[model samples]
Target: MSKLKVQWADQHEFHALLRRSEVEDKPVLLDLHSPECSGCVNHDRNIYSDPDIARDVMEYTFPVRVVTTDPDRASTDIINNHIYIWSPTIQLLAPDQTRHHEWNGAPRRTRLSVGYQTVFHDTPGHLTPDAFKAQFLVARGKAALRNKKYGKAIGLFDEAITRHPDDRVTVEEVSRWRKVAQDGGVIESTWDHQHQVTTSPLAAAVERFAQTVATLPDNVLMQDWIGKPGTGDWQWYSDCLREVVLQAYQELCNFAVTAERERARHGPRFNDTHRLLGQHRFAYREFQSLFIGVPDALLDQTPLRSERSIRENLAHMVMAEWWAYRPQILHALDRGRKGLPPQVVPATDTVAQHGEPPGSHESLHELLALYERLHLRNTQDFSGITDNELGIRSAWWELGPVELRFRLERYIWHPRDHAVSIDKILDASGHRHTANHRFAARLFSGLETAEAALIGTDGFLAGRVDSLMTTINERADEAARLLSQVTDIKPGIG
Candidate 1:
């Protein structure tokens, strides 16, 4: 076995060769490799370096070695746009740049265009140089078949059959490839780009959002908020809570209404769901008690009882959103700006018990209106707040003293967890739950991102963002998959 000096074409030279090959009616072999790719390394050492393989390449085809990692724009563009090929792809092209064939990892011909056909071949590892040559002939035959040069392809297959006459599998594969080319209706091959699942922008954003949500607590009680409120810059949380927290609460309230309708239709399945909603309402009221006492803004009001109906739940939720949480947050800002301590303000018992009775469209409408009114008032009241007030701590409660950051975290997470529960209820009721998941996921993401921005580098919020983003990505990926399904979609590869 003698060594052959192989010429590798640079980008310009490769294109010049391609042009010449087109005019001469010759096939061009492209060895597309990535410098850092381990598979590419193995391919060079194990397959391309074989003495017989090198001899045939020099004699039979115009070989172009394209290192994709090269800074050459043309080479990178070709890899990106035409081949969609991964590293170590060995492709043979017709004179016209029509991709005739490509192989990597025991390659089989797959669909590139219509009218081409080929049979699968089994190329075992540890091939002798002659066996490698025989496989190359089969590869060439398939490439011809792909180019629709049926006569040339048949002749090539015949030659391959003669070369590997002792190997029944190779002979049968050649015969099959020829037969398919003869009866070509539509192109057929068994190959896919499973190694690459490109993430869309929507998928990426969703992922980032999920990761943010994953870091925040699913539900936070007053005790937890008071016990271990972490500190950092407070501006982002103030901004995010002012904007998104209200919207998230509203969406969850809407979802709860839908769940109620589902319960009505089915009867008892949503009982647990409604019960959970009621408990969350009650828990938040207790949470409100941590930051408010009598004689302050009436933002932190406690419900007299747990919600008992859909209408009651909605009413309480809206009330909590506006009067309790919003007021408490705004009050903290006011005191912080004034350089005063966090005021402990509680609503009068009369005001606390003033929840609207449930079980009517009228009550629901009134509650919604009240929510709007409260929103307008609180938004106006808290308009002057800046991030500087973020580190303000509430008076000592059941657990300990809690800051505005922890309060915002609990606010976002607590309702978010309930919203998730509502989604589960909707799913069990046989409804599309992707919307619910997407909403909660996005809400949590936004809140977490805001919180993380506030806390900066050393904040606990920062640590959780990466993992939360991974979770969001997984969720968004799943949502995309489910959404892409056709009504009567088939099970396998399209």
Candidate 2:
């Protein structure tokens, strides 16, 4: 048995390690220590050095050490984010760098010398090798659960129970989390085992708001808004506020679509894959609405210089799915059937072969029909895809490597992306907004006012912010109800 090797890293290397963790599909084990702390020294020399403990850590996580006292060697962001006061802290972080579990201080036991006698004493933190192993197992299991690796999560939880039955604290946590995994990882509502039930109108909107907030990238969320309101730096806050409102509008549209799904004859089952597929159908419906009152002649004319005409963009959307995305999904499904772990495969170059403009002979109606057919075929291909199988990665021309879930999302959004461009063309040609679109815009304008006020206040008054969120939620629910009613309205092109 060999002792654990310590790999110390600075803040810059910590970011690289996080990227490495994502690519390798593993959590990061962060060990923070101070130079003057004896417990920190003992942890390095005693607990981590143990062979069994070292092996378990190495197998489950990407371990990195940081010295909290040294600016050159430490990650101040980690310290500030976690708000640690203890000398030695251990944190288990997911691939996205969100903390899963953390514990502070040092091992519970320490060797002591009293004259001629050697004794052992209890410390502030419990860091025995057995306890530490249980912690790693439970933390890793939670990370797996978050990543939607339900089977693997349950297996890890069971192993934690079987191996460390006497570790009561860890065992209790694993037992609770194992049930969550067993229940297909849907823990939001008790009414349905598969679907989350929003108990009230307020609850539904709040839920949508939370979901939308989660999708914002770290760069947007982590912007530095230094100084007071109306100052030079206040523009950062204003920019962030605008982005939030735009995202909220998009999410409200999605929320309304989902509400329609619940009322449909064949609703999505309580799983990510099915829900995504259902959303694709809703997206197609939304995309179809964009063409209302548009002339066929408009489809052949390019909206901007160096841009494809609406007809060409529609053709590319259909062909990309058939030639590029569909093949990757099939390859991933095949690998899943063969019981192999997901790997990055080469990208299909659909653009290279199908780069030519669509002929003027093709009508808008024909292109729409072709797209619908492709959607149905792709849906059939993804009929039995499991959540675990969705993790399979394939190469994307723009995104490098992406998961099946992302591909499914692209399947939904690719048409929507083109639809946005088409909408621009329609606007330039003096097309008017429908009643539903106009109503949604009014609701969004009201919601944007509330959101901007909340952002300007800097959330200092938590109670006031809570009240404003309630107002936003009520407005969101109203928007959802109104949008769902107009979903079936179809206007003819005159």
Candidate 3:
């Protein structure tokens, strides 16, 4: 049998692939594997190596291979409760990125000590090629059910059951889901009443915030409350507080609405630093796409009405990101951690002073390599900086004194701004080789400054608010339960 001829993607390319899947209306076949796992090895040898099975998979799904070696990527919730905790875990996701079906080939092992002896147990073995193909059919059936194609879904499930009747595990699963399709495909709720109760506090808190915003003075809402304190007029503190609260509330709601989708895409442990880094990476990816097939001659050739060429624009972004913005935030963090006062300094001019650093005018590959090095250094340096340090103010060029959080938001948008300029340059020069491949770029627009303000006030409340509310609700419930358990007796009776 020939080896599989399908394109494989890792976590880095997963988001783009998801977008493609959505646009193409195809399910995603996700293979969570580990090199060290025997079951994974067996699957590779027996299942993926078969040409017929590989062709069938490629024809129906967008296949992605996620390696379990990287903890950061593997620990993420790719689908609901479908984290990569074990090797050879296969999942098929609908176009909306919801889990349609999943199969864990082997059980995760842990040594259990009982009376000075250790014992281990294993679950089912890897699927045979025929069984594996049956599982794919079941996955397709689930996706069809989700799309309300009841007849199609029932037929698919029946086919899987008929074609691989010996695959007991898959047959049982498909049988249950087939009946579900027969009954109009209603997915049962997996969450309990406790989950519902615990999550209500977040919605209540959000509503309270909305009501509070409604009570604020109309004039206060219109004022420029983001200005540096002590520079504004009387009642400045109160007005700024109103604006801050409103922005925080808005950010909180926005975050709540998209929290699950964002977590599914970028993991659940995202901090301010991670968010900034993700945005930077996204911008660089876009930049790479724009410059991929452009001729070497166009790199140095400035576009009409534009002062800088595509190469110059990219070079400036890389230089400024590393030299100017990174240093400002890192210095502020250092000072804040050391309990030293904010320092005032003239900002270094990256454009006039640096001019195009060496290797920028070389090949596009070299320039990107240079930028990647700088980005890596920045990532390493800023990895340990916490949300608490974001409020530390530093005097920045022209913008005057601003919080480190503001600097971070600026860092995210800076490369994107340059990327837009470079895109225009490419447009002007008619280098649209990769134009059709571009997806809609996510933009912060003008919300970055407002969001930074919220961060400076409360250390990025949006990330923690949901969990905080859940904890509060859980505690309250526990207290109520305890009180109910305490028997109340009359003075003379028990």
Candidate 4:
């Protein structure tokens, strides 16, 4: 009947609250939260202030708010041990500092200790107040179950079911708890409710293509196997080469499809990828807070902008430079295969003076389409390109004359190199140096190595293998180094 008042104490006053708890003979309900956490805000609106929930807080315990990220929060040691630096965690403690309803003398909540980020992590946003209430009741019921308070757990579960009949996840979870209580088995719980994400297409493609390139026979004489040009059939060599290129090209297509799907889920365009490295712009921009501590200001000033642009521009640049010379190269090779004159065919178009402008998904699609056309053409249009063709003089248009071999190598390596650069950019963006990122990088690299083994008996070149491993390690190291340079630390708004 009276206006509800919820008293909140900062963590710095935790000891005082402990003392006050003893004086008042009440337990303490500590809300350990991050200032920028969405779940914490939900607690303020739904859990802390709801008429029913607030009555429990006001009548039964001292409600204390601990912003774990705050520098002045008391007892850094305890705070670090008990509080999740990134999420909202609630702990009920007796006046003697022992936790209420603690099971197995577990020093940590399983979800908070091993998997808090996975469970409670969210981009800052509001949830339905009803959902929030349901979550609280579920959490309390879980605690009761853990403490062997079967009747209390069942009651709380029933209450949560009544409160959120529309929430299937909650309803199913409560039903499971009721079953566990009756059957007398261990209660298994997890905070995470979302499906796990697996290997992304672009990541798979890059690693697979790298493997293909690593297996190419280097410093080996292909001419000996092809035999005298006019006398011996070179179908074996041509077919093998086409197969290698086809694999690489197909992987690119796979990456494109995956990117398209991601675009559909995340929307056609978003700049939230940029905000993982900065403090602003995550208020509701999709995928913004996916990682933290990425330095966006550095990226915008450099060439490592949107990855789509780099892929697009490079695809155009490589196409324009190679397209003019491709016909001549193809014709000469075809002539040799057909037992015609092996006369030199001059390139009709000069090397491009400069790269084309930044590209888009549409531009990349165009390039892939062209590759599809070239790939599907009959082998009669192009064949008989022996190692001897490596000596043909050419320019990168920007760099001085490089051998034909180098140009072909560029076609493969350019995209691969850019993929590595993109990896570096993400590493620098945020969370790149973390265990999860490191694990993913290693998995991807391992897959690449495995695919490369399938390239040929030649095996991955020693240098190429080293390069792939080095890039993965170096990117993580560089990102950590850059993050170390950031000063004047601050937290985003709540």
Highest-scoring model, TM-score? 2
lDDT of 4 by residue, 418-470 (tens): 44554565555442433322222333344333332222112223444344434
lDDT order of candidates, top first: 2, 3, 1, 4
Q: Name the lDDT value of residue 337 in candidate 1.
A: 70
Give the residue spans of candidate 4 off by over 4 A.
12-28, 33-47, 60-62, 73-79, 82-85, 89-122, 187-494
Indicate the TM-score of model 3.
0.34
Clashes of each: 13, 0, 0, 2
* lDDT, candidates in the order shown: 0.43, 0.54, 0.53, 0.41
Give lDDT tens digits, candidate 3, residues 100-147. 665533323211223111112222344678877887788788788767
lDDT of 3 at 162: 88
Kindly report which residue pairs in candidate 3 clash with one another.
none
| TM, every model | 0.33, 0.35, 0.34, 0.32
Least accurate 10 contiguous residues by lDDT in model 1: 291-300
Better of 1 and 4 by TM-score: 1
Candidate 3 least-lDDT 10 residues: 435-444
| Model 3 residue 63 lDDT score | 86
**Alpha carbon lDDT at 426, candidate 3:** 81
- Candidate 4 — worst ten consecutive residues by lDDT sum? 277-286
Report RMSD (Å) for each prediction in the order shown.
Answer: 27.2, 27.0, 22.3, 24.0
| lDDT leader | 2
